[model samples]
Target: MPELFHKVLKAFSSMKAGVLLLALLALFSALGSTLLPDSFNHLILFNILIIILFFNLSICTFNRCRRIKRLWGAGTGIIGGLRQWSLIILHIGVILILIGGMINNWFGESATLRLAEGEQALIAQDKSGVGVNIQLEGFEIELYENSMPSQYLSHVSLYKNSKLEQQSTISVNHPLRYEGIKIYQQSYGNLVEVETEGQGQVDSSTVLEGQILEIADSKWQVKVFKYVPDFDLAYGMESKSLQPNNPRVIYSLYQDKVMAGIGAAPLGEKIEIASGYYVEFKGIKPYTVLKVKEDPGLPYAGAGGILFMLGVVLAELKIFSKPGQGNGNRKAVVE
Candidate 1:
């Protein structure tokens, strides 16, 4: 029984066992990447590899710790002790990183929110349930010359239990964090607000272009034909110069299967077509797209990364330094 236990320990602590486990892990990882297997299959493979590596690392670390203890008892000096300790620390850091990755893969959450200025919405966790409230205070789009979008900005406020907790601006490469959730600016779009009035009744609608809306008791079908950020008329043809200085929309109005009018309506302007019936463009608002993420294991991963780097530096220094001069001719051997 004693010999069998010894053999089992030796097998698990051997470098050959570590190498075999690593090779198998690499093979499965490569296959997963190339075949693009289902997410479940990939997860199973990853878990199996992690389990094998975890046991192998535990046994190896235990054996190394015992060996180092014996060396220290035999009066090995400070440098040799430092070298062995650094290697152990490095292995522990790698294990922490793997654990952190597993935790993040299984438990992290992400969602997207589309909000217009002054709009409030509940932030959901994986679309499951509302976790918090977020209000879009403002949205801005920076444009370059020739009217191309350069950057998107969203100023938002976070609320918890109906009380405001934080307010911040998020943009490309700039993120806001609240209670372990990170919010990033993703995209922006234009929205048009339209209102129609007839016969002492008022109807309001908000839509994007290419959408058809019925207002004032379904008698009038309004279709937004085109939207121009900058409207211009040249040579009797409508032209949009692509600058957002003068936003307008070309809309078509129909009443009882007959085209009433087709014309351009500028922002904040009202056009009367048939007596008391009129359409107004209430201007455009920028809607912002935000990506929210929550990963609890990120801090663990960061700490592991820092420790791994420090261990590497310490190990390298010990390796390159003069061997016998440091600590009484005792050399540390790292596997």
Candidate 2:
């Protein structure tokens, strides 16, 4: 068992093993990007690979540091000692980066919130399990001379349960953070409001495409299956542009998980789900998609990055030379 353990440790500390681990990580990344529903960070195999890489790095660093200490003790000069120490520091920095990324990927909370102006939606719960919500109070787009959007901003209010907690205006660069949760305005789109009137009950909601909207206390549920900003019926119902020149929606209605009806219509048109049960595309409005995240490892990763740069600079320093090498006359060899 001890011999096997030594063999395992030796393999982990080898450069070839590290290279193979990196290749496997890249393969997992490609698979996740092309086929998986979630990210590579969310995969068990990816995490296992990360753990393996971490151990490999740790062992390599340990062995390298031991060799560096021996070099230092052998009186390799101050410059040589610092150069060797800097290499060790670089190794440590990489290890810290891996650990930090693992912590964030495993424990962080990331969610996207799509909210229209004057609409509130649940952002996410905090570390303490407090439900947080964000309301888009107002939104504006600044246009340039060519009628292009220069910038967009969102005035938002954050609430915990029923109490207002914070209010701020967030944009592409400026993000609002509360209790480690950051909200950034990632994108903007148009929302289609659907109205339902049936059996003496009237309900309405503005929903994004693929969002299920409930009506009449769960008696019926409807979702906009697709929305074309510039619907062109002649081109196989494809959108001509993303400009909303002729907005159209394809919707599906369900009752008890069974499809009751499906219809396609232009904005403000109505379709019957059942006898006297009507659903209509009321109107379109602007909405914002906010990227909400809680990353506890961000600081560690940042610190590790700084340390890595510092190590690079330190390793590049060649301030001193051997006593017999002459003053600035001898060339320094880099290994």
| Model 2: residue 238 alpha-carbon error in angstroms | 7.6
Q: 220-290, model 2: which lDDT tens digit per residue?
A: 77877878777776765566655668878878788987888876688877777777677888887888888
TM-score of 1: 0.63
Worst 10 residues of 1 by lDDT: 234-243
lDDT of each candidate versus the true structure: 0.75, 0.79
The best candidate in terms of TM-score: 2
Model 2, 194: alpha-carbon shift in Å?
Answer: 3.7
Indicate which candidate wins on lDDT.
2
| Candidate 1 C-alpha lDDT tens digits along 1-335 | 99999998888768788888878877877887677643433387677777778778777777778988998898876667777777778777767776776677678767788898889888743354546789999987777886677888898998876778888999999999877888988777667788877765788878876677666755777777767776777612344554666667888888875887788778788777567777788877668989887878788888878878877876666555564555443345543
Model 2 TM-score, all chains together: 0.73
